[model samples]
Target: MNRTSNPGDNQTGTSQRPFRVTEDELERALRETLAGRVAAPQPLAADPAAVALRRARRSGRRRALSGLALAGVATVLVTAGMAQLGEPGGNHGTPTVVLGDPRGFSPAPLPTATAPAPGPVRAELDLILGSRLETSGGEQQELTNVGPVERAQRLPDAGGWLMTSATPAGRTLWWLPPNGSPPQVLLAGADAVAVAANGRQVAWRDGPDLHAAGLVGGQLIAANQTPAPAGAEPVGFAGDAVLIRQPGRGGFATWSRSAGARPGPTAPNVLAVYGELPDGRVVGLVAAGKPGRPCVALLDPARDLSPVRTGCGPELAVDGLGAISWDQRWLLLNGAGKAALLIDLRTLGTTVTAHPAGPPVVAGVAWTQTGVAMHVDATGGLVRVRPDRVLDGERPTASTIDGVAPADRPVVVADAGA
Candidate 1:
C-alpha cells in the first residue's frame, strides 16, 4: 500500500495496512547487498577484550553504513541534536523496558488500528530559537526572535507552545488550540516558561544558577532557582536537574542540579557517553578490559542499574514505557533511517513499512513526544505514529503550513532531508 508521505504537516490517517518485511542483515550480507563489495567482515574472537573491541568497531561501522542508507529512509526517524523519556513496572515506572539486540533476526507483525475522525489536531513543539516546524492538524510555528531560549522548549503533552522568550514587550507565548481555533499567547518573563500539562513551571538561569517558577491553575507562584556551580556553565535541565559541562582536573566534567541544590555526580566522565531512556534511566557505556574502561552500563536512578537491560543495542535510547520503535518492535539498525540501521534483538519480530518520503541519509536521531523523528540530511520532516493505531507519518496537502498563516514562518529543525 502506498503509505502517504508528508513530513511537512502534523499527523493524520488512512486505512491501516499490514507491515512489510524488512529484516536486519548481518554485517557480511549487508556489505555484499547494500554496498555490493567484498570487504571482509571482522571476526569476533571469543575473549572478552576481543569481543569488546569488535563491538566498538561494529558500532563505528554501523554509523558509517547507516549514512549510505539514510537517504531512502531518513524521514522515518528523528535525531539526538542533543536533547534526550516514560513509565515503569516499578520504580523504573510501570512499563516493560528491554535492551534487545538490534542485529539478531526477529520478525513481528506491525500493529494497526483506525484513527478517529478530525485526526490529530495540534501538537506542542520542543524547539530552539531559529528553528522552524509545523504540526499535522494544520498548525505552524516559528521562532521569530533571538531571545534567551537555551533553556526554553515545548512540552509534548501541552497545547500551547511553551516559551521563556518572554520580555516586557507584552510578548506572548502562543498555543495553537485544537478545533481549528486561533492561537493564544501568554505573557512570559525573563526566566519564565510553561509546560502545557503542568502549566507554567518556568525555569531560568542566572550566570551558572538555574531557577523555576510557575502558574498553578491560574495563580502565579514565585519560582525557585537552582544555583550553578562555581565555575561551570549551565548546559540544560531535565525536570529539576541542571546539566553543566565543564573542564575538569583531567578531562571534561558533567554536573547536574535539581531544585536549588549544588551539583553532584562530579565525575570527569563526559555526559555524551550516556543514554537517557524514557523511564529516566541513565545508560552509561563502559568498554570492557580497561579498568573504568567504558562498556555500555545501564543506570536507572529510580531503580538500581543492576535490573536494567544490558548490552543489546547498548548505545541506543532503549525505552521502558512503550515499544522500541513505531511498530512496537526492535528496529533493524540502532535507528530507522538509512544511515543508522534499526535492528531488533527480540525474537523474530521484524517489519518494513514503506516510507515514501524519508531522507537521503540518516546519522543521529532526536525523539520528540509525539513520535520518534529522524535526522536525515535532505528534507527534514516528522513521522507521527499513533501507538496502537498505526505507525504513519504526516504531511499537508494544500501547501498549508500545518495551519499557520502565511505570515507564520516555521524553520526546519528535524528534516528527513537535511
Candidate 2:
C-alpha cells in the first residue's frame, strides 16, 4: 500500500515539471541493474506459492501505477490492491454487460478510487453473430443495437468498450459505456487496425495514423501520423510508447511520443506479440518445431538482445493476447485434437486438459478468481480449469457454461468494483 511519486514531482519551483517515464528507460535500467549485480536474494517470509499468487494479484496495480505521460494527456493510474468494501444491498459478485441491444445497464458507483480488480475477471466475446459482453454465468447482452462488428476490446476498467464496425467505405471506431448511453464515434478510417490498451490509455491504428485516448472517456488525446514501415502494424502500448511490428520481423520496435520510432528487442521467428507482461516482459510465440509436433517457444521480454525462451511445445499455441493467464506463468495453448494445453512457466512443463464429452476446440482462455476458464468452440460453453491439476497431468474436470459459445476474440476484463 506504500505509494511514492516520481522524483520529478518533488522539484521546488514555481513551474512544475511533468511526470514522464518511458518503456525504453525502464527496460534499459532493468538490463543494466541485472548485469552489474549477482547477489543472493532474500528469502520470502511466506509460502512461495502464496507469494506468487500475491504478485499475480498485484500485477494489474503495478501496470496502472507505471503508466507514462504522453503529449500532455494526464494518464489515469489506479492501484489494484485496495480493500473490497462492499455497498449495502449491492451484488458484489460477477455482473454482465451485453452489446448490440437496446437493453440499458445502470452505471453502478465505481470502486472507491482504487486499482482495478484482480480476480473474477470480466470478458467480452466478439463473435460472428454479434458482440456479447458478459461475466461468467452472468446475464448475456449484445454490444449495441447497431449492426454486427468484427472487433471489440473491453476497457481495462470494465466500465466501457471500444468497437470497430466495417462498412462499404471503411471502418469506424465507436465507444459505448455501460450506462445505456448512446454510442459515440471516435473516428472512421479506411482500415480499422489493431488496438492496444493499458489501464488509462488506449492506442489504436486508424488508417495510417495511430490514435491514443483516455480509456474511460474515449476522448482523442494524442495521434501519431508517422507512416509505419511498409507493412508494420501496431501490437500494443508499452508505457506511453506504441509497439509496432512488420509482417516478417521477429522483434518489435517502439514508437514514443517524443522520439518518433526506435527499434525494440527482437526474437527469432516471432509469430505474434501478446503485449507486455505486468513485469515488463514482452511475451511472444517463437517457432520451435519438433517434426510434426507443431511446437512454439514462449519468449518473455528481455533486457538483452536475446529473450529467455521459457517453454516450447505444439500445445503452446500462442494465440497472442487471449490465451495468457493473469500471472504470466500459465499459457492456454491449443491442445493436440480436442483439448487445451496449459503450460506452466515456472516449471517449463506442459499439460493437456481435454474433456471426455464436450467440444473439440478451445477458442479462448482466461484466469478467474477460482481457477482457469476456457471457451469451448464446439459446444459454445465456458470451461473452468484447475492449473494445479492440469500441471499434475491429471484429467482436470471442467465446468461447462451453458448458452455461451466460444468467443472469436475473447478478452478478459477485471471488474473494477462496479
Top-TM-score structure, candidate number: 2
TM-score of each: 0.38, 0.53
Q: Stretches of candidate 2 above 4 Å error?
A: 1-142, 156-158, 166-171, 197-199, 248-252, 257-259, 262-268, 288-305, 313-322, 335-338, 349-364, 376-379, 389-418
Worst 10 residues of 1 by lDDT: 77-86
Q: Which RMSD values do the candidates have, in order? A: 41.0, 41.6
User: What TM-score does prediction 1 earn?
Assistant: 0.38
Total clashing pairs in model 1:
88
Q: Per-residue CA lDDT of candidate 2, range 65-122, in tens?
A: 4432321122211111112224455444432322222235455555555666444333
Q: Report the number of backbone clashes for model 2.
A: 16
Residue 193 CA displacement from its true place in model 2, Å: 3.8
Query: 1-418 in candidate 1: lDDT tens per residue?
Result: 7667576644447425554545654555676675643455555556798879999999888866765455324333222211121223323212222223336636464444557545322433333313343453344454444343322333334433444333555234444343434544444333323232223444444555545555443333675655655555433333344334444432122233344455555444332222334455443432334343333344444332332443422233221111233232333222222323332323321222322222222223333434453332323232333222222433222112233333323221221110
Question: Candidate 1: lDDT over CA atoms?
Answer: 0.37
